[model samples]
Target chain A: MKLWTLTEGNKEFINETGSITKFANRFFIVGMKPRYEFKELLTQCYLIGYKSLPLVALTGFIMGLVLTMQLRPSLIVYGVESQLPEMVGISIVREVGPVITALIFAGKIGSSIGAELGSMKVTEQIDAMEVSGINPFKFLVATRIISTTLMLPILTVLADAIALFGSYIGVNINSVTSFSLFFTQVFQGLDLNDLLPAVIKTFFFGFAVGVVGCYKGFNSNKGTKGVGIAANSAVVLSSVLIFIIDLLAVQIADLMGLNY
Target chain B: MGNYAENNMRLGIFVLVGLIVLIFAFYMVGKNKSIFGGNFELKARFSNSNGLMKGSNVLYSGIQAGTVKSLKLINDTTIEATLLIDNEVKSFIRKNAIVTIGTEGLMGNKVIQITPFKGNSPLVKEGDLLESKKVASIDEMLQTLSRTNDNIAGISDGLRQTVVEINKSTLWKLLGDKAAANGIESTINQMHQASINANAFSKDLEMILSETKSGKGTAGLLLTDTAFATQLRMALVGIKSAGDHANELTLQLNQMASDLKKDLDNSNGFLNFLVKDSLMIKKLNATMDNIEKGTDGFNQNMEALKHNFLFRGYFKKLEKEKEKRKTIDQSLRIDK
Candidate 1:
C-alpha cells in the first residue's frame, strides 16, 4: 500500500505540473488575443496593487526596521554602523524588498485569486460563462495573470521605496540620521544593475504567483472543501515559486554580469 | 460603470506613482553615475586597469565627480579610459592630475581616482590625456602579502627555534640559580655605578658647555669679544711684519756669510789673509816692533835738542811767545 501510494503521489505531482504548464500556455494564447480585458485588468490592478499598498507598506516598513535594528549590533561590532543605510539600501534594492513583498503578495493576492475562482468553479459560473461564449479563460485567467505580471513590478518598486523609508526610520531609532542623508547614502550604493534585476524578477514572481493561484482555483474540485484547499495550495505554491523565481533571477543576473 | 471607472482611476494613479518611483530611482542612479548632468569627456591611461570597467565610479578628491564611460586596451601595457566627468568639477581638475585605479571597499568594485595637483596649471580640458599611475593590483598585493606572510612565518619559526635553543641553553638555569643571581646582581650594580659615572661626566660636559655659552673664558672671549679680536688681529699683523723684517735680515746675513766663506776659501785674498793668514800676521808683528823702536829714538833726539844752549834760546823765545799769546787769548776769552 505504501509503494502504491508513493507511485500515486509521483503521478499526481507530474500531472499537477503538466496541468499548470498547460494552463500557463493557454493563458499566454488567450491573454494575447484581440479582446484584451482592459477594464477588468484595471480593476484587478487596483485590487492587486493599490488595495494591497497599506499592508505591503506596513510589512515593508517593519521589514526595514527589524532588519536594521537586528543588523546594527553586528555592524557596530565591525565599526561600520555608519554604513547602515547603504547596507540596508543595497539589501532592499537588491534582494529583500522584492522577495519579501512578493511573499506577502502571494499570501494576500494569490489566496484571494484562488478562493474567488475556486468558488466560481464550484458554482458553475465559469462553465456558465463558457456556454455564453465569453471565452472564460480570456475573461478570468488571462486578465488576472496579465494584471499580476504588470502590477507586481510596480508593487515591488513601491514596497522597496517604503522599505527604504522604513530603513531610514530604523537607522534613526537608535542613532540620528537626517532624511536627506539617509536617502543619499541609500542611492549612493544602489546601481542600475541592482535596481533593474530586482525589479525585473518581480515580474516573473508575479506571473508565477498569478498562474499558480489561477490554476489552483480554475481547476478546483466540484466540491465545497476544494475551495479551501485551492486557496491554501495557491498561497503555498506561489510562495514556493517566488523563491524559485528569485533563485533563477539571481542566476540569470550573475550570468549577465549584473551581480556586482 | 462609475465604480469601474473609479477603480480604473485608482489603478492608473497607482501605476503612475510606481513608475515615478522607478524613474526617480533611475535618475538617482544616473545622477550618482554623473550621467544626466552637464558633463565632459576626459581621458586617462593606465598600465593596468586592475579590473576597472565601464561605469566604474570616478572619484575626484574622494568625491564622486564622474564615471568611466569606456575602457580600451590601447597597447600591451596601456588601457585608455574615457571618463564622463561632471562640468561642475571642471575648475578643480588640473592638467597634471594623476589617475589611479583603486577598489571601492575591501571587496567592492574598482574605482578610478582623479588626484589633482596643487601648483599652478591649466584646468583639464576635454580630450586631454591625464597622467596614469600604475597601482598594485589585488593579485600583486596579495602576492606581496603572501611573500611577507611567508617571511613572517619563517621568522616566527626561527624565533620559535631560537626560543627552543634558549630553553636548551644554560642561561635559563643560570638565571634560576642563587649563585648566578648574586653574580648578576653584582654585575648590575657595577653597571649602575658606570651609568652614574657616565651621567656625572655628561653633567660636567653640560656645565662646560654652559660656561662657553656665557662668554666668560678665553674661548668665550675669542668667540664673543669683538674688540679683543680686533686687537689680536692687529698684533698678528705686527708680528707678521716683524717676521718679514727678520727674514730679510737673515737673507742678508746669509749673503754676507756666503761671501766671507768664499774669501776664506781663497788663501791669497787680502780679507782671507787679514782673517786667517799666519805669515801676514807675523810680518805685521815685526813691522809694529820697528815702528815702536823708531818712536823711542825720536823722543831721545828731541830731549837732546832742548838741552843744547842755542836750541834752548829759540825754545825759550818760542815759549815766551806762546805764553804771551796764551795770556792774550785768556784775557780775550775770560768771560766771553
Candidate 2:
C-alpha cells in the first residue's frame, strides 16, 4: 500500500511538472507576441506597482523596525550595537528587503491578479474576449507580467530606502543616532555587489510572482469557488518561488564571487 | 481616460522616486568605493595578504578613504596590493605611509589601513609602493594560542609530577612519622617555655623599673635620698682632707730624712763615727764581750760572798739590819 501511495505521489508530481511546463510555454508565447498595449501595461503597473506601494511601504518599515529591535540584543551581546545600521542595511539590501517586499508584493499583487483573472474566467469574460478576437492573454497576462517584472525592482529600491529609514528610527529609539550618521554607517559597509545582485534578483522575484499568479488565474477552473483557490494558490506559489529565486540568485552570486 | 492619466502621473512619481532612491543607493555605495571621486593609486607589498581582498576598504587614520583595487602575487613570498585612494586625501598619504591589513571588528571583514607619516613629506605619487606590514591573522593567533596551551599543559604536567613525587618522598614520610612528630612537638614546647620565660623576665624588669620609679629599693634610695647624697659629699671632703694631712706627714718624713742625712754627714756624731770607723767598731765589739764576761764573774763573786762564813755573818747582819729597819718602819707606820 505504501509503495502504491508512493507511486501515486510520483505520478501526481509528474502531472504537476507537465502542467508547469505547459504554463511556462504559454507564458513565453504570450510574452513574445508584440501586441503589448502600453495603456494596459500602465494600467496594470498602476494596479500592481503603484497601488501596492502604501502596503509595501508600511510592511517594509515594520519589518525593518522589528528586525532591528529583534537583532539589537544579539548584537549588543557581541558589543557591536554600533554596527546596527550597517549590519541591518547590508541585510536588508542584500537579502531581507528584496525578499520580504517581494513576498508582500506577491501576497497583495499576486492574489489581486489571480482573483481578478479568476473572476473574469469564472464569469466567462475571458471567453467572450477570445470569441470577439481580442487577445485576452496579451491584455491580461503579459501586461501584468511585464509590469511586475519592471516595477518590483523599483519598488524594492524604494522599500529598501523606507526600511533603512525605519531601521534608523528604530536605532534612534534605543540609542541617539543622527540620520546622516546612520546613513553614513549604512553606506560604509555597502558595496555595489551587495546592491546590484539583490536588485537583479527582485526582477526574477517579480517575474515569478506575476507568472504564477497569472498562470493560476488563467487556468482556474470549478467556477466561483475556484477564484478563491486561484488567489490562495497564486500567493502560496509566488511566495515559494520568491525564496527559490533568491536562493538561486545567492548561489549564482557566490559562483561569480560577488558575495564579499 | 482621466483615471488613466492620474494613474500615469502616480506611476511617474513612483518611478521617479524609486529611481532617485536607487541612484542615491548607488551613489552611497560608489562613494564608499571612491568611485565618484578623483582617485590616485598606490601600491604596497606584503609578506602575506592576511585575508585582505579586493574592494576591501582602505582606511586612513580609521576613516574610509579608498578601497583595495587588486591584490597580485609578486613572488612566492610577497603579495602586492593596489589601493585606489580619493585624490582629496592624497596629500595626507605621504610617501612614507605604512599600509597594513586589519579586521573591521573582532569577526568582521578585513580592511587595509594606511598609517600616514608625519611632517611635510612628499605626497605619495600614483603607483608608488608604500611600506606594507603583514597583520597577524586569526588562524595564526589561534595557532600561537594552541602552542601556548600546549606549553601550559606541559608545565602543569611537570608540576603535577613534581607534586606526586614530593608526596611520595622520604621527607613527607618523615613528617608523618610519630617520633619525628614528637620531636617537633617537644621543640615547639621548648620554644613555648622559652617564650614564657622571656615574658616573665620582661615582667620582672618592668616591676623593678616601677619599684625604682616609686623609690622603694636600694637603687631607688640611691636615686632619691638627698641627705645620703650630702653625707657622701661630706665623706668625700674628709677623705680629701686626710689625704692632704698624709701628704704633709710624707713631706715632714722627707724633711727628717734629709736632716738625718745632714747629721750623718757631720762625722763627729757617735752614730756617724760608729758607721764610718772600722777600729771603733772593733773596740766596741771587744768592750761588749768584756762587759758580758765581767758581768758573769761578778755574779759568781756575789754568789761566793753570799756562801762564805765570814762574809756570810756580815751578810746575815746586814740582812737582819735591813729586815729590822723594814720591821721598824712598819711598826712606826702602824703606831702612827
Q: Point out the worst 10-residue segment of candidate 1 chain A by lDDT.
A: A30-39
Where does the lowest 10-residue lDDT sum fall in candidate 2 chain B? B265-274
At residue A187, candidate 2 shows an lDDT of 94
TM-scores for candidates 1 onward, in order: 0.68, 0.70
What DockQ does each candidate score versus the true complex, computed on alpha carbons?
0.62, 0.72
Q: Model 1, stretches more than 4 Å misplaced?
A: B103-109, B135-336
* Top lDDT prediction, candidate number: 1
lDDT of 1 by residue, B25-123 (tens): 999998998869799999988877778888999999999999999999899987899999999999899998998888877777799999987789999
Please tell me which predicted candidate would have the highest DockQ against the true structure: 2
- The lDDT for every candidate, in the order shown, is 0.91, 0.90
